[model samples]
Target: MEGDNIEKNRWACRHVLPLYASLGMADEVERIWKVCEYDPRLEECTAAIEAWGKLKKIEEAEAVFDKLEKKLRSPSVKLYSILLKVYAQHKMLAKGKDLVIRMAESGCAIGPLTWDALVKLYIDAGEVEKADSILQRAAEKKSGKPMFSSYVALMDQYAKRGDIHNAEKMFHRMRQVGYASRFRQYESLIQAYINAKAPAYGFRERMKADNLFPNKSMSAQLDQVNAFKKTALSDLLD
Candidate 1:
């Protein structure tokens, strides 16, 4: 074999390093990134950084981020969002929160994913009050539509704590946003009453007055209601 052709590493690194990094081949990623950094293309560097973040390799991701041209890295909103997502998933709450403040200060439009990450971080940190406050701001803030998951997530925390009053309050807030369906209130409202070991007749009557049809998903709640009813009857029998 007397071939004398050589393939340049630039093209291969630009196109394939991200894939290798994503597939968890850290060594190959480092090798390719070393060559690719000489050219400093935004697309390639972004891919490499994203791959590192996807793999949860914080140091590697940071290295790629640093290797990006200063201008290429400075105003990149997508890159910030990606990094914030990784930060949230990895429990790097402080960094994620700092990035959020920075994004807001820089006027980089915060999207739903970033907001979701912040809320999740608060919830996971046992700062349910903060999470609720964020949901409140989301509802009241003119910047973006309130995320339904935010509402449900806060309601979940309240329900878990057997907080019927706040859970009902959240139900009212959800209704104010036109999420007044009977189904939406089951986990958010009825479950609170059930967990609190309190009768839900008032809520049932309210639903009846609202003319909520008994959808199929209501069957289990109906069964729960009947079970509670039998317990009451048995108590009176005693």
Candidate 2:
């Protein structure tokens, strides 16, 4: 069992836990995971956790985390972040937030990327105010660059609520932080304006170039928006 080829196989196995998750082979993944737990390598544990998370096996992933506590000296921040990400993926925002706080209290520095995951989850949940609070807290930190993507997300949320003032604030923040104002960002705001029956700048050309013909529902919505405006399709095109 302790031969060179066996050694090579073991080393190779160390790398495949992530692969199993990517390939979505949950049973094969668990088989490899059990072997890693018995042998107990740090990299293996990390990979196993990630594999489980990717497969959306949150309970199994948490089980591995629980099992590893006795064997590893202390888990790395990367490992904890992965676990937080699993919670977020499952829409368990409160659980994810609690994990971050616990990890911080235990002196593990959960970074901005970790916070961003929770912000995304809150946004998906339509809890825009909560997402804003999380972004504000993360910004208050001394470290990390400005999260431009967070502002874009906030812009989308504000647009959904038809809060143009707040959406504009986020758009300015994105500009201040040097984020390229992407087309989807514009679409969200335009959609908000259309829904609110308000005048939206650059509406027609953006729609035509966006190749939005496939969506019948959206096309009908656009017709309604078009009715209120004085400008024609040609005007928008021009």
lDDT of 2 by residue, 1-238 (tens): 2235533567655577788789989987877766567666767777777888889988888888777765664667777777876776778877777877877776876566766776777887668888888777777776574466667778777877778777767766665545666655665666666656666555556645654432565556566667646455546888
Give one digit per residue, the lDDT tens place, for model 1 in 1-238: 1123213545555567667766888887776667666666777777787777767788777676656525553546666666666676677878778878877886777665566667877887788888778777776766676667777888888888879899988878888977755566665677776777666665556777777655666657666766777788889999
- Clashes counted in candidate 1 amount to 0
Off by over 4 Å in 2: 1-19, 22-24, 39-43, 67-74, 160-163, 194-197, 202-228, 231-238
lDDT of model 1 at position 83: 66
Poorest lDDT segment (10 consecutive residues) of candidate 2: 1-10
The weakest ten consecutive residues by lDDT in model 1 span: 1-10
| Pairs that collide, model 1 | none
**RMSD to native, candidate 2:** 6.4
